[model samples]
Target: MRAELLKPGVRPREVWAWAAFDFANSGYTTVVLTAVFNAYFVSVVAGDADWATFVWTCVIALSNAASLLAMPVIGAVADARAEKKKWLFAMTVLCIAATAGLAFAGPGTIVWASLMIVLSNLAYNVGETLNSAFLPEIAPESSLGKVSGWGWAFGYCGGLVTLGASLLVVTQGESFGLTFDQCVAGTMLITAFVFALASTPLFLWLKERSVPRVNAGSSTDSSGTITGAVAESFREVTRTLKALPRYRDFATLALCGFLYQCGVSVVITLSAVYASAVMGFETADTIFMVFLVNITAAIGAFLFGYVQDAIGHKRALAITLLVWLAMIVVACLAETRGMFWAAANLAGLAMGSSQSAGRAMVGVLAPKARLAEFYSFWNMALWVAAIVGPLSYGAVTWMTGNDHRMAIAVTGLFFAAALLALMPLNLDRGRRAAEAAD
Candidate 1:
């Protein structure tokens, strides 16, 4: 770690810029993935509840799987070239463009809607990986947890704003002489605008600090073709995977992350659907519920961030997972809207805490030289969970005639398995190992 980054005098502007990226992209997650567009895709676009759920899961799973393969290579290449910021900029532009394109999707445009979402989501995940790679460079190890929490906390605020705006548009579109479909499409455009406009601070203020590492065998040839670069990236990823066993604590943490995120992924991706299908929430009600959750989520991220730094990363994560477990049970058993709302609040707290703690732990456990590569693996775990969680929920729902409660109960098992995986994690030993590697 650099002396200046370790000192209390680290630039506030740089930290804010880094945090701003989270604020920027979170609009997409709030509007497109979680709150507005997803329900629109299912009910209006696809026009079939069960089939829409299946298609939604398939889109999420396929895009996540594709990104899972691409991220490690992208991270390896960025780390070798010391170009995290460059890649981040490119991915951000793609995400914004794809999100903007969603405005063209309307009734009977299911295929177009799915394609746009997949592309935008893929770019968003890539950008997320690159953005997290900057953490160690921007903040000291001592405050990494706080910084990570602040980013997520800021992100929830962004989500809250975008969701609130979408709710207004969704509810009032007809009064303004627009159809419901037009209003939904317009919300997508607003999300893209929010993402692009808010992300400017990151591009303007955050500097890339990692130096390029050009190995003789890995450097591009005089022809300037990316073929060699691509090959080198795959080789680097392979080398890192092979070396994982040597970093026992980091590897264990990765497994724990993968397991817990399965449940987390299901909760975030399908909570709206659950409200609609299981609890009979209309579009406005679902959006309002998500808006409420975002408020509490911001508070949780802000508070639990310091909790992780004060106690320890693993302990904080364990506590959050327990919260998730309880919430899942509550959600499954809830017979009324108010009961589900209670579960959503708990989900909000666990959601923020788990993400903040997981990111901080990865920053703490990874050797600085391979920070991007490690975060790539961190993304892989989440993507893998993305695959299993949604697909399982979809499969169970489809087979059981849209019985979402049973599928939700299955999600709780993922959390329980994750807690068991965390039993052996030793944060102090992991920190020592990372420092030794440095």
Candidate 2:
């Protein structure tokens, strides 16, 4: 089956170009969202630990909610006009600009910093949605898992590189006559530049593959007025939502994805905070730990990419979720730094596997004509989880008097629920439905 689906003459350069976008954007995920900026925002910018937890969660929830509402509409428009690359490029620029602006956010600039985070995160999420939609275009069905895995692997490497650079600036800034705050600000500029430089190949080399479809309710004409295009996009989005129930398997998968990401998002967003609050890890220690996670995550992504193709995406995802469940348990029980480090590595393995397998599943299940729209739905699940996960964690932590372990324990329940949700998904049926639509 794999051999039959493989396209003999697919251009390798285009495949690398497509994967390069992942490599590009991961700098922001690592430096800003995961490692440096988030902790900085909470500890320095907000100036109160309890207040910072609540505010950070609120900011993340609000930003993710906005992106959730906007992505499907933007995706519909991009799909209608066959302009995925164009939309991707626009969002990329928005993300880079916002990330760069973070350099100006100092200790007394909470509002400014919060605004930058919201805008940069929104652009990053939307850009990622567009990027994932391109998978089916560049890779054959047989190789979707492998290609997605390669992209994730590249992303981890990119994170590692950028984080390593940030670590240097952070740990050695005093030697170079820069203060801690100045070094943190320098990392933001580094993130922006690395993202812009790494993403160049994607815009220049990858071509949009989908053609505009003829429809009365939606304008496929790229030359049409902007207002008309936007209106048509909204119409298409409404139509898709109404029609979603018929795609039961896809809907089930999306639900499962949302539940799983509830756990994943919380961990990704708050790991540094957890380490600092629970285990008393300092800035350099947290950075080094994240560096270790990225290394293992890259290895896990590369290995699990082939595993999913061999065993099936659904099975592979379930396995990853189980790993995630164990990770949460480990975090809950670990009282020592060594024990927490072990759990962190487990998280790295699950993170890479689940992400690679989940994206592959979406590529396999989505109708070719509406790939972007379906990925928009996928992004919606992620954003929704982003909202629910952090808010829930924040509430729990607040109620428990900043007990991060208890908050992390709650995430385990989300993983358990996600595994149960996956029980109802019929991957074969979903694949058949996608093929029939095609």
Best by lDDT: 1
Tell me the deviation in Å of residue 187 in model 2: 0.8
List ranges where model 2 is wrong by over 4 Å: 1-9, 216-231
Please give each candidate's TM-score.
0.96, 0.96
The total of clashing pairs for model 2 equals: 0
Q: List where candidate 1 sits over 4 angstroms from the true fold.
A: 1-9, 220-224
Reference-based lDDT, each prediction: 0.87, 0.86
Local accuracy of candidate 1 as per-residue lDDT tens digits, 164-200? 8888998998999998888888889889988998899
| Predicted structure 2: lDDT | 0.86
Q: How accurate is candidate 1 locally (lDDT)?
A: 0.87
Backbone clash count, each prediction separately? 0, 0
Candidate no. 2 TM-score: 0.96
